[model samples]
Target: MENNQDSRQRFAALVREHSHSMFRAARAILDCDADAEDAVGEAVLLAWQAFPNLKNQQAARCWLLKITVNCAYGQRRGQRRVVYMDDLSQAAGSAPSPEPSGLWDAVLRLPEDQRLAVMLYYYEDLPVAEIAKTLGVPQGTVKSRLSRGRERLKALLREEEAYGF
Candidate 1:
């Protein structure tokens, strides 16, 4: 019983530590804040259920994030809607900044696979191997996605500059 209690405590602490990352990963996949929150909650529950099966405690972060990404994908599949990015920003509880950066806008415009790879690798500061684990893709695939995402972002920025928006 004590062992189970210890495991539960450890899991809760880890969840707290990585909650923001989990939310960000979910938000990257889902269209709205409510969906993202739901995904994260579901992921946490799923992770708890499978926590005992997890072998490498050192890889907990990647493992939790992998669960989160999967949950977010599931949520997105269930709800198909056209939601504006501005609405998402507002729902996240932050007023629109006077100077909105186009880099993030371009990142959001990338293909889903590339966007997730970029967000996990760059924004989350996860190593390529860890990103591969989190994304369930091979390291080479993650590298390729990052490469393509960067190229796409460059083109998007250039277009934005040309249009003077």
Candidate 2:
């Protein structure tokens, strides 16, 4: 049981280290700050329960991100209703930094697969193979998503610039 305690401690430390990245990735998928936080909370609980199954601590970040994305999807699925609110002040206060905000909004507009690929690659700095494994897709598929996402982001950014946003 001592070993189990040690493992749980280590896992908790790793979770603290990667929590921000997990939240960002979740937000990229879920599109709501509160929902993203909820997803991360759920992911952390699920990950802690499964900590004994983690073999390589070195891959913990990628592993955590996979859990986060899955939880975000589950959160989206569990939402019973969608309410459209025109009030923007609450959301405006939660915006990321200027550079990331522009890029983030563009990324949020991309298709789900592409948004995920871009987030894992650029935001988390995971390699292609690791991303493919996390996403459970072929390397070619991940690459395709990245390429298409970039093209779409470029166009979106251009439009934003033209609109002075």
Candidate 3:
């Protein structure tokens, strides 16, 4: 049996390693930095409570991300309304590019399921199996969503280019 200190240290190391991924997952769902931060905070607290019960240390990243995503969904549901005060580009803590990229815009326009799958697969660099486990979907479903999201992004980018926007 693991001692309490060892458990705590292991949990802390896992959280520290995956914190950025957790925030990105939350951000993907919530679309608001503050709300995403709140979701991540809530996920950490919840995960801490559940850590002792976790069976696989290797699966910790997916487990934490799944918690973050659920918390983000719950946060979205609790909000009566969503207000966008900052430009989406500014949310990443960087100055807007002189030529703003439409790729991210197209991604935002993707259907929620496709968007989540794409973000988890590409942005988070998660494998399809892990994404499926994180999102509680089948691997085939995640693959299909990624395929569709790519096609949609290609069409959207083509349209943007043709319009000279």
**What residue pairs are clashing in model 3?**
none
Q: What is the lDDT of residue 116 in candidate 1?
A: 91
Please give, for residues 1-165, the per-residue lDDT of candidate 3 as tens digits: 989999899989999999998987887777767888999999999999999899988788889999998999898899886556556557868785543347766777778888889888887899999999888889999999999999998988888798776
RMSD of each: 4.9, 4.5, 4.9
In angstroms, how far off is 56's CA in candidate 2?
1.1
Provide TM-scores for the models.
Answer: 0.79, 0.85, 0.80
**lDDT of candidate 2 over 1-165, digit per residue (tens):** 458678778888998899999998898888678889999999999999888888887888989999998999989998887664533544667554344337877888889889989988998889999999888889999999999999999988998888777
Error of 1 at 140 (Å): 2.2
Segments of candidate 3 deviating more than 4 angstroms: 86-105, 163-165
Cα lDDT tens digits, model 1, 14-81, are 99999999988988887667889999999999999999998898889999999999999998888767
- The candidate with the higher TM-score, 2 or 3, is 2
Which residue pairs in candidate 2 collide? none
**Ranking of candidates on lDDT, top first:** 1, 2, 3
Give the least accurate 10-residue stretch of model 2, judged by summed lDDT: 92-101
Each candidate: what lDDT? 0.88, 0.87, 0.86
Off by over 4 Å in 1: 80-102, 160-165
